[model samples]
Target: MNDKVLIVGAGAIGGFYGGLLAKAGADVSVVCRSDYDVAKHYGYRIDSYALGNWQLMPNQVLRHVSEYQGQPDYLILCTKVTADIDRVTLIRDAVAPCTTIVLIQNGVEIERELQQAFPDNLLVSGLAFICCNRNAPGEISHLAYGKLILGNLSGRQEPKTQYLRDLFLGAGIECVISEDIVASRWQKCVWNAPFNPLSVLSGGLATQAILQNQENFVRRVMREVCSIADACGHPLPADIVENHIALTRDMPPYKTSMLLDFERGHTMETEAILGNAVRAAQRQSVDCPCLESLYVLMQLLELQIRSSSLLN
Candidate 1:
């Protein structure tokens, strides 16, 4: 029997990955908001640079969680982590007791809340290293790399995690299971801490442009993140910084998800990506001046966005 999967926040990340699971023969359903009409009518159209073009017709297209037909084996949360969104509340109604909750979101130290909320359910933390975006309603463009790292937050090598990995692999997607997913989050943040906010602060610049103009600054921020991770007892790889810089240099010129949210006037993951890391630094007595500065600037930008929204 195919595993039942329900995708919450079917945006770029959710749509792309959920579509892949569908391709792997899972009974994939989506709770769509912005693209509800289009998805309900035509399903999702995915164009991938590596995998090629395809269409994903979800087993169910729902406007809300309560409308889902049955208990899903997996519930994947791919929403942007922001102050304005209460993720647990959004999906509480449909989360069956037996469901494995998977969060494929950005940020360090974001798993605790869900763990607390669903203490009995298995919680998996996941990260997607991909350059994907929704060009229009129900249309996703997979511009570059797409690899997923998943692991149980409890540090156990859960069978479900392996099963999910096998599912992705079956669809020709690279999926790695990690014993320490938290450290992986910090490692990814090494790149996100700099490029994401810098893209916004630079008045809309792509990753390559920001790195080209201010490579030194980018490295400094990444180092600060590494320091915090080490202090928090999740030491990253020794050459993580250089690896990230090299990867960015070779990546296609792309606007980050944060910058894209800013462009669309959507809530950005300022707190999730930068603020949480800064707080972790403070708690561990780690000196992260560069990371702290980025946190403050993003806060101000978020405030400005809120203010503009109120007036307009």
Candidate 2:
């Protein structure tokens, strides 16, 4: 097995994958900022109720991209959606000629941006089904859902993609190579569109925000997102709203990344989540009132947060 896996953006998703791959005996090198010391000291930890595990250390860890002596077999980019687009470029030159870039971020358009730079490298889109958060510098709490869906841009299964799937499956992670990755990505977006923003706005767990009996806000937000996806030629199922409602209900009390950023006083990824859908809908001449309202409301909320921070 190709042992070298470089996981960029050592955040929740990256750490989870790195930790699991490391436990599976892959030589995992993580690229992060100054927080590398904490990860190095504690190794990487994964806490899960569904997976019935806690904090497995990786085989290896590193701070800088330059510390990687040779090219990597796979580059797992798990940076935040709102991060600079140029960070991927720094690592693009470090990969082997046939290296696969598996993006495990939230937004749908990150693969497109990456493809423009490394056109020849195999750019894969992946959807993460876990509620992972960076509790502290080195600690990560993976509440539930450790399944992964991976596919190529053409949505075709090739030898390379299969190998990657096998690697993850061997590590005891549920890995699915789907022919409908676009739909899957959009499906995850449907799940995130409401829960992420609602958590940010209402300041609560995603399950709490969506599963509460009184608030139809969650359904309304997802309805608009589904409509927008349909308009952009994806046409997600109508029950997507209900599925998310149930999925969140089954999960434990957990805060979404959006709310975490809100509490930490960081900017929320409104454009990447809701704005991308709205832009696609407009391009395809579809109406998305709910998404629009959410976008506007978030922008206002962000502005208020900024103002309050400035005053303080």
User: How many clashing pairs per prediction, in order?
Assistant: 0, 1
TM for candidate 2 is 0.88
Which pairs of residues clash in candidate 1, taking residues 3 or more apart in a chain or in different chains? none
Residue pairs in clash, model 2: 46-55
207-249 per-residue lDDT for model 2 (tens digits): 5645675358777777777776676667777788887888777
How does model 2 fare in lDDT? 0.75
Mark the 10 consecutive residues where model 2 has the least summed lDDT. Answer: 51-60
TM-score for each candidate, following the candidate numbering:
0.97, 0.88
Model 1 per-residue lDDT tens digits across residues 1-312: 789999999998999999999999999999989999999989999999999999999989998899999999999999989888899998898899879999999998998888889899999999999888899999999987899999987789999888999999998889999989999999999999999999998899999999899999999999999999999988999999999999889888989889988898888888998989999998999999988998899888888877988999
Q: Could you say which candidate leads in TM-score?
A: 1
Each model's C-alpha lDDT? 0.92, 0.75
lDDT of 1 at 242: 97
- Supply candidate 2's per-residue lDDT for 307: 88
| Candidate 1: Cα lDDT at 10 | 99
